[model samples]
Target: MLPAPLSEPQIRTGTAAAAPAAAAKVAPDAAATAPAAKTSAAPAKAPPAKAPAAAPAAAATSAAAASDAQPGLRPTTRRQWALAGILVALAVIGLTTIVVGLARWIAGLEPIAAFIAQYPGTYELPEGAPIGLPAWLNWSHFFNLLLIALIIRSGLQVRGERKPPAYFTSKRTGQKVSITVWLHTSLDVLWIVNGLVFVVLLFATGQWMRIVPTSWEVFPHAISAGLQYATLNWPLEDGWVNYNSLQQLAYFVTVFIAAPLAIVTGARMSGWWPKGADRLNRAYPIEWARAVHFPTMLYFSAFIIVHVLLVFTTGALRNLNHMFAAKPDDDWLGFLFFAGAMLVVAAAMVAARPALLSPIASRFGTVSAR
Candidate 1:
């Protein structure tokens, strides 16, 4: 009746109809008004529509810059780390040579032995302390070594990751995480499990007496043992029956103290930890976890190095026999067991690749390529 109501497309086309008229009105002053024309017409053409869109883009850029500005962990460069290792190795060799020379030349090696013998640093066993390495202990030792090696490998990979090689997304909640992190956390769980088993067996079998300190004399004994070690006049090799004070203390710290500290700190930094628990996060911040976890790893690394060296250099056959064969007698059987254990360890290393892990990761969550 009044004119059919314009369709949606017609209304849109009507806006263009007014443009020619508007342009005609400004045509006479086109030369002088050109600049003004552009300024006036730009809003109609694009500005209002584009301005709102630009705000979000600008905000996103600012957010990214702010995130980049935040403080992050800085890892030592590989070259620097390698150089430090070389220096440490040289220092160990140099110190050992000098100490041995002084022990031999100054007062003869016998005096050094006498000094070690005179020190009252030996741990006196109570009634019926467990003696000799048990089969459970031998197996547990190998398992612990394997788990620790894998944990460290994955931990270093997680620490140095600049960009993840793959990602894991939760099937239920669509949460995403890096694959390296998955491996690291998985290894942590395994290590903890193995440790718990070791602890239970240790107590059940009365082997706690071997590692746990029973007397204050352990301190002086540890010092004496340490000095004897430094002078290349080590205490008697009797690990099958008993450990020296230094060994006892080291095992005590590793089992009772350091391990627990590592577990707590590691859990705090992991995905298993509950998120947005303000009080808990405040009490145990990520910074604390980061600070403790890394140094603990270094301590384990150093301990392993020195422990292995002493095992080999002090009495390889006896040490190997005790750990691998669970026997006091020296023979090639222990070495054969060691070789088999190493092959298992090697197979584990080979299977830890991203390609292999990605499929396994998919069972827990949706795995994606980075």
Candidate 2:
């Protein structure tokens, strides 16, 4: 009976109390979520800022490292290089002609009389001592020797021009083909020996870099050389412009490219290449290597013709004098020594006629140049 007295009013009050408890639970949840959102948002922003800053710093460090590894490197001593170059040229003038003269004298199939006739008998050629003598009497002896080297070098450079020495086919093949090849290559060794003297003199004399072109060569490099016209002719360009800018480029390229190729190919033909075929093959494919090598010789032979023609057309005898003579004034004497010795080598060439000198000339007519 007492409990019943509580009835409607008591029931309402109890429900209201339950509502307040639910509201309290909801309030706590909202407060907890607010702090989490604030903290998480702040950490996210911090990470982005820090990431951007660190990225640039890392990028800068990497860039600096790259520059050091590139080939944009500076030279060691420019003045020394200039001096060395000049001395080499001087040495070439003094040494090349003399060797060619002596080789010619011994070869003996020369057209000239006094040149080859001077030495008709064989005088056991001293091994290391100057290979040819008498006609190679003066300092010009050295020059003539150098000329033979250049000729051999030039001869070796023609494209598909001559067959490679078959000495390495086997011992038997070597006996048949190698003796001459060995003899010919021996000249290169001899030439290199003499070249050492100049290598020393380059530093000793101090005249190397002037002969080499400078950095301004870049301007010429950018220009379209094909546009340049040739009015006069070779050796004597259009006028004061002896070698056109284009011609200069060609000359420089020859000095740098063709000559270097000849050297590499020659080295390949020598013993060094067989052991290191991988390196040589990079420049040319295996099948095409010999094809490319021999053809280059022919190509260089064409260059010689162009060069000789240019010299003669431009100032022939004078240029020859400058190249062969000891003193500029001494070209005449130098020419005699060179030409005379060449006659003897020419005789030897005719007798040997390795077919390398002129396969076509033999069929068409008898003609050979030492």
Candidate 3:
């Protein structure tokens, strides 16, 4: 379930390790008071040396406490039960890690390692399977990644936003919308366009053959490949030629199923759909769209995470060159291009901050905090 948006003030104040700073600031006062109190209670100089030695220890303890108080935004949640559940799960994982470490120390981890190494299955390519990934496919892959990531970011903003930081309005009709929603819808439109182009190019260049399964044997092969991956005995890296069955199946589902569903569901939820269409809305419930949309985002997120991990781990240089530099060879050019692309993404993220975005959003339409 989606958590409610945290307040702007809470987000800001919670960002710094304010607690530790406060403690450090108060400690000097306490030290001074202790010296004065001792002087009043007893006699003489009140052992000034004791205060100096204790000061160092107090400083050390405060610094240690500051380090323990991790420096980052502390998320504020209204749902204490849900927060408690997350904490409990984290504790369980920590305990499990300790248990595993102790067990390994007492008895060799060979048995545990052997169990993890068990992977079963065979991978086979159907006849006529030496097709290569084309240049257009590589370019489209990068573009699709960029657009989809932006869309997901904006979509989350729209969903959790209680008060829009900005707004967009139609010049012709004088209709207005929160800028968050406008950005989400606009990215969806762009994603749809990009997807359409990808689809056309895939079929035009006959690259669809690589992703679409041709035989029933593909299923068994996919199962085998999945098992291999689960057991950490991953399949061979040969994306320059045909993909393994599991990879093909995953691509097919993502391209043919998930993308289309995201577009359709987003469209239905957007303002472009005719309002007051009671019959149409009832026939295809908006609730169904709502239910499917978030999970689809999650699926895309998972796919991207695993895809990048494999791309790097399997063969970083070759994979980077293949996707970025459009060359199959392992070379520095691809790594350079990949680094540049990451910089661009980082810049976009920084530019997308509320303060930076609100003014641009105002240019298209009226903008207000609420």
Candidate 4:
């Protein structure tokens, strides 16, 4: 049945025919799979294209975070604050001028003149009152000025310091405080002692009578003197003999009322207060002391400003003599002493840096970086 094996050409033709049929069958399957493959590939390519769009949103978010991190007043807000300050200053100046003008006009009236003539701004002191400032009083004044200035500087430093440059640890008690606080407390102690001495001397020498008002007439006289001052026609310069009614009252308030209040409030806030005494602490809370202490400082500042301004304006030479030289004459000696005292104050202020203070502080206690 072999019929003589098939020729080569016929065999080739048969295989070729089978191959085409197989190819036709496979073409349909490939067509179907191509669509699905392309769909999957399309999504993958689309993600890369969309990636750039998200980048801008991410950048915007980062920028917003950065802005929030740095907090500060806006330029417009700062400008507004500057403008407000300027307006307030102008308003104050305008008000002061108006008041002075009005006071001047009122003081020119005949009735006011007669009233001024009656009071003359000062009443006679008690017969036993001291006539002039003593040498001890002048020395006390100088020391008081020096100590007060230093105390104020240290106090301000303590209030503003977030990171203290140095700390002071008590040698015996092992309590620690900022160097600024230590200096402030130390100056306060010295000032208190000096004040005590001044008070003792003032009473012992009968100098208190000059500052302490003894008559109801002082009120009207003080009002008259204030009016005179407002009008730029100040009361007579007679501090060497006796202060004006207003001056007397001011001194009395400063020495008696303000100083005691400052001391009490300061003590309440200071570390010197017994920490174990919860009952005392509850009775006079530290918060109350804090509230009062700042206002007391402000009062002292105002008093110093007004006192210095009046001393310079009313009669510089005579007042300087009365305060510094313990004399009534208007000579250059008092001015020289005042200048020297001021130089000392300036030197002390300049030398109050941590570098200089640390060594001195270490003498009494251990000084360390905070």
Candidate 5:
């Protein structure tokens, strides 16, 4: 049944009375639902947390894949290069053999045979030419061999070294250099001094005429000698009395041309060059020295190889006697001397290591590892 509307004060009183009851009814339901809400939210947050952990793992996987794809240089490449070198050597040997056979066949011709007979691979030395190798020449030759070998070894070290084992600071100018360079320069100085003495003695003893060509006929004779050597039927000659035309020419070029070139180029590249002389530097650039120096080294290397081969093949005993014993006989004395000299050279090479060289280097300069 409809009842009369309550006054405004009664209505407010009723709402006020109902408010706590409504809150009480809702409180338990909200409490029970709060845990569910937290659980759901925790799952949502977990994915994001786990995402950061996955990133590092993914990055490591990608790095491993990249490394597998682009593996650096392999040892097989080095082996391939070695194989190529062997093939080239074989090709050169084959070609040389073919050329030698062809040369022998050509020499059998009448015209070539007559030319060979007329020249006989050498011409008579001038009347004033020295008769035999002197004792001084033998000593100088030994020194030259030793010094050049050491120089070459040190020079190679200077070129190939990435980190020098020691440094040298000169006491005079306070200029610093690598130990290899210092050794190379020192050897160069000694070699030059020896060369100067050799030149002085060569001229003093009238031995200059032996190596120096006195006539224009030397060209034809040298050609004849080359042909004979190429045919492997080398001409018979006594080196003590007179060198063949080819030998004389080789000596002349080595002494006069190659030696001077090496010295000039080496000086240009060395610390001895006056850095203040811009004009000289411009005229003879360092590039020129670099270009000329390596080729000079190669020439010397080739000369040594061929010289030793000929000395041994042509007449080992007699050649050794001429070189070492300063005599013309084929006795074992020269061979013994040669063996001793070789032993000395080997010992020097072995002692050229940093451990031994450092003490000697410290005498002229302060040596340190930087």
Candidate 6:
């Protein structure tokens, strides 16, 4: 089940940490008060030393209060409870959707074939589809495209103009392998497989409308989108633009650059390239995957440069909310959920990207410092 999206503010550790900071602030004030108390006792000269004793007592009391209340971090509000209920309902619906969708796909029927008994000539069809995909799988590619676009856009919003240097590498040569290269490549593979299935189905069905850019004014669309991206002039003479030129371009690049790299690298990894399988079978497996994989890092870096600029340039939260949420909020809560999703995406990227690239580069000692 898709987890209930967190609110815009709840995942905010930066703001949440302020509570402890405030508690810390209270301690200084108590310490300051102790010094003033000594001044007051100076006139009498009797209670001067006793004033110092109050500081430690106050500190201990403050520490005890903090310790007791630490258990109550993030006290739930009425709004949170309501949101939780909605999340549960949504999860049920999502689970149902999955069951229903899988039933249709696996049983090779339109819907609910798994739930109901089949009559004679009910057509026991092939599993999935002929072109390495099941029927109606094109929708997933579309979703993947949209999600990848949003991820890139949100990533751009977070880090733009300047790139984060490669996370890990060889210390001897100051060499660093880019994490972006690996991330974009993996997602590209998944996206491409999703897309390849769709493309195959499209060809098999002769549905060229989806693949062929049929609009006569496509050039104008590209131009206008370019202007919006370059000049930040949104409200770009619109008729419900599903994707702008910038969107199209990035998607196009992912398809062309990152996606191809995955296929090539995968070929190298699996030893599928230069198909003389029997003679040169001794060659290192997946080694060929490494040769073309590094360039993908550069591609990802370019994508990031443009991606982050648009996030803040457009409303970051608003842009992100549309990507992650099933229901649109158009409010702060929507943005928060978007943030939660992106944080997950970012964490996943950070963890996985390093794994994919680091081993490959280190194996060859071909990595360069970023």
Best by lDDT: 5
TM-score of 3: 0.66
Candidate 2 stretches greater than 4 Å from native: 1-177, 191-211, 217-229, 233-251, 271-285, 328-338, 351-370
Q: 1 or 3, which is superior by lDDT?
A: 1
Give the Å shift of residue 310 in candidate 3: 1.1
Predictions in order: lDDT: 0.84, 0.47, 0.75, 0.88, 0.90, 0.51
Candidate 4, 1-370: lDDT as tens digits: 5677779757866786798699889977876778776645543343345645776897799888887886563345888899999999999999999999999889889999899989879888877777888999999999999998998888888889999888999786678999889899889999999999999999899998988899998999999999999988888858888999999999999999998988999899887788789899899999999999888888888999999999899879989999999999989899999999999999999998878989888888999986
In candidate 1, which residue ranges exceed 4 Å CA deviation? 1-92, 98-115, 171-174
The TM-scores of all predictions, comma-separated, are 0.73, 0.39, 0.66, 0.81, 0.80, 0.35
Candidate 3, poorest ten consecutive residues by summed lDDT = 115-124
Model 5 TM-score, 2 decimals? 0.80
Better of 1 and 5 by lDDT: 5
Off by over 4 Å in 5: 1-72, 76-89
Better of 2 and 6 by TM-score: 2
Each prediction's RMSD to truth: 12.4, 27.1, 16.4, 17.9, 17.1, 23.4
Compared with the true structure, what per-residue lDDT tens digits does model 3 show for residues 53-141? Answer: 67578779988888679654446567967888999999998986776566545333565445323422324455655466667767777
The TM-score between candidate 4 and the true structure equals 0.81
Find the 10 residues in a row with the least total lDDT in model 6.
116-125
TM-score of 1: 0.73
In the range 67-103, model 2's lDDT, one tens digit per residue, is 6676466464888788989999989976756655654
Alpha carbon lDDT of residue 122, candidate 4? Answer: 88
lDDT of 6 by residue, 1-370 (tens): 8988777545664465676699788966776768666646634344345645775897799888997889667588999899999999999989867765654355455342322222211121223322222225424533554446544543343334256445444344444434443334335556667768766666676443322334544444554444333323352321111344345446556755686675666556431245557555465454555666555645766766676676456665554444444333356764675456557656555554444566754663444446
Clashes of 3: 0
Prediction-by-prediction clash tally: 1, 52, 0, 0, 0, 10
Question: Over 4 Å off in model 6, which ranges?
Answer: 1-212, 232-241, 256-258, 269-292, 327-329, 346-370
